[model samples]
Each structure stands twice: as C-alpha cells, then as structure tokens.
Target: MSFRPVKPLALRTGVRWKIAVAIAAVGALIAVTLSVVVHNAARISMLDNAREVQMERLLFAQRMYETSKPKEPRFGTKINDPALPAQLDQLMRDRRRGTFVQEHRNGGPPDVWAAVPLANGDVLSLHIPFADRSTAIMNDLDRALVIGSVSVVFGGCALGVLIGGQLSRRLRKAAAAAGRVAQGNTDVRVRDAIGGVVRDETDELARAVDALTDALNERIEAERRVTADIAHELRTPVTGLLTAAELLPPGRPTELVRDRAQAMRTLVEDVLEVARLDSASERAELQEIALGEFVERRVRALDPDVVVRVVHDSWVNTDPRRLERILGNLLANAAKHGKPPVEVTVEGRVVRVRDHGPGFPEALLKEGPSRFRTGTSDRAGQGHGLGLTIAAGQARVLGARLTFRNVASAAAPGGVGGAIAVLWLPDHAPTNTGSFPMLRLSN
Candidate 1:
C-alpha cells in the first residue's frame, strides 16, 4: 500500500549441514570416549585375572613339592627359579607374596608374574603369557569397538541431516511467505500453520504473519474505500460552490471567496487523484520524450519564476502525463511553502527540485510524507500533505524512483537549508553495446 520497495535478507540454507556436522562431532566424541574406556577396562581386567592365576599357581607348586605329590605344579611354577623376574624376586625377599609385570618388545603383549616365599627361605615364582595368548581376542574387540563407533557417528550425522532438513524447509517456507507479503502480495497465506493446529515456533511465526497480512490488507482496503467515497461525494458540491463563488459581485470579499473555493476545488481534485492511484487501476501511457524540453515546458507553465537547468538531455520512455503531474505537484509545493529562486535541474536521467526554505521536518524525512500530516505553521503553512504523496504515487505508476532529502543551504539570505526532491528515471538500457537514436552518450 505504501508502494515502497521491500528488500529481504539473504537467507542462509546451510543450517542443515551445520547441524549434521555438530551432531556428528558430538556422537564421535561420545563413541570414541566410551570405546577407549571400555577397551582399557577390559584389558586391565584380563591382566588382573592373569596376575591372580600366577599367584595361585606359585602357591600350588610350593604346596605340591612340600607334600611330594604326583601332579605337576600349575605348569611354569618353580622354587628359587633362576629365570624369575627380578622385580618379583626382590618383592618377595621379605617372605611376602607379590605380583609383577614385565614388558615385551615391538608392541607385543607383556608377561604377568607372581612370587611367594616358601618355608625354607626360598621364593616360589610362576609366570603366565596370557596377555600374548589373548592378543588376537583383544585385536578383535578393538576392531569391533572401532566399527561400532563409526556406525554411531554415521547414524548420528544422517539423523541430524534429516532433522535439520525438515526445520530448514519449514523456516524457508515461512521466510518466502513473509517476502511475498512485504512485496504487497496479500494472497500468499501460509496454510500449514494457520487455524488451530500449531506445532512449533515456526508455526507460530506463520500464524502471526498470516494474521498481520490479513489485518493490513483489510486496513488498506478500508482506507481506499473511504478516500474514494469522500472524494466522489465532495466533487459535485465543490464544483457548484466554485461556480457560485465566481458569480459573486467584484470586491475584496468576493476575491477572497473565489480563492478559497478554488483552493477547496484543488484539494478535492488531488484527493480524487490519490484515490485513483490507490485503486491500482491507473495505467501509464508511456512515450518517448525529450527530458530537458519536457521539464522546462512544465516548469514554465506551472511557475515561470522557477529556474530550470538541464546539464545533459536524453530521450527517455515514460508516461508524459504522469511525469507532468509529478513535476507540477513538486513545483506547486515549492512555490507555496518554500523560498524564492526554486530551481529544477536535469542531470541525464535525474531531476532534482530544491527550494531555499527550512528543510523538511524530521518526521517527514524519517517516515515519508503521508496524507493530512501537515507540518507546523512556524515553517510556514504545511498544506494537506497530499502533494508529495500524489507525486510519489505517480512516480511509481511510471516506474520511477522518487526520494526526498535535505541538501546544503542555498545561496540565499536567511537560508539554513532546503528540501530536495529527486526523481530518477528508470533506465532499461539496451542489451547490446551499440547505441540507439534516443540513447544519450555518457561521459
């Protein structure tokens, strides 16, 4: 309804992949941590069991030799054995039982040994190579753990991708709907999250946006209808009033009456034009025109006192009538509310109209001009505020950009600064490099 352009942010669609990577990292960390812990725990348990077995074998051998029994003592068991591990032999010197381990070379399994003191001041020791024998089983367990860790990581990554894809899809759909709404497409309704079955935040967002668009559309329609109705109702009566004022006897009072009536009539016409623009039924009758000549003629016809300076002229395609209306409104506003020496400058495709008066109000600059939002009288009379509004709407109809701003002070006495209204013609230049007849060469 405002006819302002909408610029949407660049939506990032990589969140799904980011989610997948994050989940995979977490899963891998957990899986690898558990794998290492479990493998270490199993290895320690097996080594402990071997140590216990060696200690029991040493005791059994010493007992069998004492009793002179028949069965050979727990295989590798001997008394005061020269091949006993030095660490275990020294550990048992105080007539106490102890266990010790010995390392093997080149990543092979270590040996487990235990020793005990006999009654004759001799040490009985035994050793078991269970670690070496269990090497194959340990390797198999390591492989299994590694495979399981990999499986968990891959599974987590896939699951993350699935979940992120769904969320991204939902969010993207909502974002697109919002973009369309911003572009004045009131028909784009997000059906999935509307009604009464909202399931997530995205649904809530969709519902809120849908409700807002409905409200805005209804408000715009109501405004347009009211404007059109008021303008139509007042048109015939204002015309009759103007006719009646002109028939009055020639006097100062009569002159005042005619001026007021004419002003009211102008206001009614402007209101009607605004209503037409709002209805979006107006189409531009585009034609090729000489830019400098067209603007100079309009300015002269509107206000002979205003200055026109054409830096470079170019033939452009646009609606001449709409462009006239736009320029007329701008010149009228400047003449009525601005200082003398108002000037119009045409620089290639741009037209600037500036006046040496106090700059536009801060509110006008920030929020743009609106109907009936006249400024305070201290800066002179701010009219119905429909002049710029109409001009902007006409510019839009002609596919042009209209902007307002405060430039530097004009070279005039008692001048701080003034408002500058700029009109930039749309340039749909030819695709080919060669120039055409209407195209102006740029320096």
Candidate 2:
C-alpha cells in the first residue's frame, strides 16, 4: 500500500530549536568577551613587571654615578678610583638608557654612558636587557591568549550541547503527545520532572500541550455522545415506517410504500453505523469464516436470479455482522440499479460483486465515494446515496479493503459497465475459527 506524507503541524512553532540556538549564541558571545578581558589583563600585568625592573636598574646606576663624581665643581673630577673602573665596566654592560655615567680609566671610551646628563653632573647607565624583557612579556601574553581562548570555547560548547540535548528530549516527549492527540487520542498528556535545576521553558510548554490535549478530549467525548444519542433516537421513527408498510394491502400501492419505507429504514441504519464506526469505544469481533460460504449465503439471500461463483475456500477473520451488512449494501445497490443478472465471486479471501448495468456514472467513478453519493440515476425510488458510505465505514471497522471500479466486460450492453467492488479480508483470518459466528452490530 502507498503511504501519504503527514502534513506539517500548524501549531508547532519549533520553539525548542529556537531556544537552543539562542543559548548557543549567547554562550559564544560570553566566551569571546571573557577571552578578550583575560588577554588584556595578562598583557598589562607583564608590562608593569617589566617597567618595575627597568626602574630598579636606573636607581642603582644613579647611586654609583653620585659617589664617583667630585664634591667641589672648581676641582673637576680627574682620575677615577680603582673600584670605579670595575663598576664602570659592569655598568657599561648594564646599558640602562634612563641613567648616565662619564669618564673611563684610560681615556678610552667611557666605561658607561648616558643619553642625557644627570642632575648632579654625572652620567648614569645600567643594563636590564629591555629587549629580552619586552619579548618575555609578549610570550606570556600569547600563552595567556591561547589558553584562555581554548578553555572558554571548549567549556562553552560542552555546556551548549548538554543544555540542547536535555531540551530536545523534553520537546520530543511533548511532540509524541501531540501526535497522539492528532490521531484522536485526547487523553494523552505530558509532564515534567520537578527540580529547580531543570526547570525552564520546555517544561512550561509540555504542561501547556497536556492541558490542550485534555480540553480537546473533553470536546470529542461530548460530540460522540451527542451523535450516538441522535442516531438512537432516529431508529424509532424508521421502525414505525417499516411496521406501517407491513400493514398495507398487497398491491402496487403497497409495494411502492414498502419499498420507500425500507429505503428510510436503510438510511436510519446507515446513520447508526456511521456513528458506531466513529466512536472511540467501537470494536470489531474477529473470527475466521470460509470466504466462499459467506459470499454464497449473502448472494442466495439477496436474489436467486443472481449467479455466484466460489473459486476458493479461503477463510478470513472479521466481524460477521459487519461483514454481512457491508455485502448486503453492495448487493442491494446492484439489485436496485443493475440490469438483470449480477455476479458474486470469491477468490481466496477477496469478494467481488459485479453488476451488468449501464455502469457507474462517470462523475462518481472518477470522484470515488463522497459524503452522500448514491451511484444510481436520480429516480424517485432509488436510494439516497448512503449505501456505499456505510459499506465503506463497515469495511474500515473490520480492517478490510474495499475498492470500487467499472467492470470491464464486452458481453455487457455498455461494453464496460457497472461497479466491481472488491473487499480483501484479513491475511490471518484462517487461524481464528473457534470464535462466535455472529458479531454484534451496535457498539
């Protein structure tokens, strides 16, 4: 059998996906912001440490220069002390730019020099390896940047996945409940686990879905009771009509009255069958019966002139009363509108009823069954179009397949005329034969 795709639900806004995406986006933003702050703070702390080292080197150089300088300006400083030469050599290597020093022991280049003069007429100098200090600071900043970014990104992704999974699970439960509701299960509902940690919008949505399902089920129950009651009430008038027709005299007028009254009774029966089929509490009695025997019995009851051919003794499980009603309607339709000889055939579990008439109307053959379509011509004595509908409903309740099509036979007056209705019985029907033979007609 071919399957039809389900329609998209109009009520589902996909709020779960939206919520998960929002959480992921916010997490990404926070991770990025935290990374930036950490990187700047690490760089600033490294720079401050480098500056402090430079200041210490500068102070040491200035103190050395002050002690080496002459006390009086008139007698300028000449030969330097022995210790001065050693200190100057070390100071020259220091290369502290902010401090300065002058005069070497041998007129050679001054052991240490300053870019600018000091306040005490002394040039102070020191070396703290400023280039190496700057490079170390930069390396520390780079490490901080890399580590901070990786930690934030990984942590954020983990959190997002955990949250999304939890939310999706809850939403899926709610979705399943909604599907049950759509399939006519109004009592289905969903509830959330109680915990402050897990409490969120998904829980709220599940509660809302459950509430809606309960309300819908109540409405459906009310409508079903009303329909069943109405159908019950109608049977009385239909029974009266049948009884009144029976009291009339045996003549042409009596025949016409009986036929019309029977039609009304059939209509009332169809209404009740439809109500029963639609009710949620309705069920079918499944039992195995010989397909050939069943078809022969219905054909014999309908008309002796009609021919029936049984090709197989296959058995099928079905509600016998409903099965009888379905075949009764099909045979009645053929007898009422069909030309002289109708044929009932059974092959395996399939029963086919064909009539040698003018064939089904073109419009109905193409459109199939509708709400109130009687396939016969609109004569005053013909049916009111509920025969096929009731038969179809009965077939559904028994889980059987019923199809209508024009019979292709050249011997018929119309060449290809009338309807050939096929009903396929349950595949496992032959196994359950010990059950009751008469299935109840009412729910």
Best by TM-score: 1
Off by over 4 Å in 2: 1-24, 65-117, 120-141, 144-148, 192-211, 242-260, 290-315, 324-443
lDDT of 1: 0.80
Put down candidate 1 lDDT per residue, 22-71, tens digits, no spaces.
99999999999999999999888888888887777777777776787563
The alpha-carbon RMSD values of the candidates against the true structure, listed in the order shown, are: 8.8, 12.1
- Per-residue C-alpha lDDT of model 2 across residues 1-443, encoded as one tens digit per residue: 99999988786545445555566567667767876787668656654565555456555544554575543221222222233334454554464233223444664332232222356444443333335555566667678766766666566656666776676776677677677666555556566332235677866877887787777667866775786688689789878978988998899999998988887777777766666666634557676688799878877886777789998878777778888888888888787767657888899988898887777776666665554666545311366677777787777667677888887878866577566889887663221232334546796
Identify the candidate with maximal lDDT.
1
Local accuracy by lDDT, each model: 0.80, 0.65
lDDT (C-alpha) at residue 218 in model 1: 88
Q: After superposition, how far is residue 128 of candidate 1 from its true place, in Å?
A: 7.6
TM-score (all chains, Cα) for each model:
0.68, 0.56
